[model samples]
Target: MRTNLDFSPLFRSSIGFDRMLNALEAASRAETIDTWPPYDIAKTGENDYRIVMAVAGLSQDELAITQEQNMLIVAGQKANSDDVEYLHRGIAGRSFQRRFELADHVKVVGAGLVNGLLTIDLKREIPEEMKPRQIEIRTGQGMPKAETKQIEAKKQAA
Candidate 1:
């Protein structure tokens, strides 16, 4: 498929974070990768996500999980059986690799193998200082210095 991307005006517009833009571009070009080894991405909470990939017949020793830059790669290599002759090999246990893009401030909590399913947990954390704070617009200069000073003194005393 041959197609043209028109971005003549994008260069003139204000672009932020070239890495983020590059990630978006890469995501656009990347398909679902593959449907095999089906997986599920579920939202556990408001800021938490869990990825469950059905990698049956794969042991924890045969699989590895690691994060590189902003990408998380889950790969596995099944120890090939040299002596076994299969009359009917239905399950193709060769090897597979899966990649996922981790958003900003997102960190992988941990991963575990449960019933042949690899469950990876990720969470986004926003620090109290980084969280949005509402500023109260004082109509006058501000609260009485005496009261503010008293409050500060009380906090220090505590």
Candidate 2:
């Protein structure tokens, strides 16, 4: 079951928040989806993150990891184990696929599997042009008014 949410009320007051609203809507809709192969997302550093998933009974070959733009996908399909018979199967050997939405400039740095756990490392690499930079405010005493005006004019022309 799904419910329709009227976002018009929220949209009327917010400016330049369309992307954020869309992201929120997507997350709300995903709540009804499956959560197989439990996973945890954690922040390790200032701009670093890690996603750990419990994927027992799966090898590196059985799992696949892919990233398309801002989406990260991890899938696993267990091989045929019909040869081994078990009276009662407790461990889950089923296949599952998980997706994660990464923020801008966030990238998957590496991935590894150890002790039935899959760990994926991520880092947000903001470009130099995008990173916050401090502007050096110039004081009038440093230069004469004429030079400052000429510099301003040159900058305007450029």
Show the lowest summed lDDT stretch of 10 residues, model 2.
147-156
Q: Which candidate is the best by TM-score?
A: 2
Tens digit of lDDT per residue, candidate 2, span 1-158? 67867676778999987777888877766666687899999999999999999998899999999999989999999998678989998989898889888888999999999999999999999999998999888888885566434344344553
Q: Which residue ranges in model 2 land beyond 4 Å of their true spot?
A: 1-4, 9-16, 31-33, 142-158
Q: For residues 33-133, could you state the per-residue lDDT of candidate 1 as single tens digits?
A: 67878999999999999999999999999999998867899999999878999899998697998888888778899999999899999999877899999
- Root-mean-square deviation of candidate 2: 6.6
What lDDT is reached at residue 8 by model 2?
69
Model 2 compared with the native: what TM-score?
0.80
- Candidate 1: lDDT of 50? 98
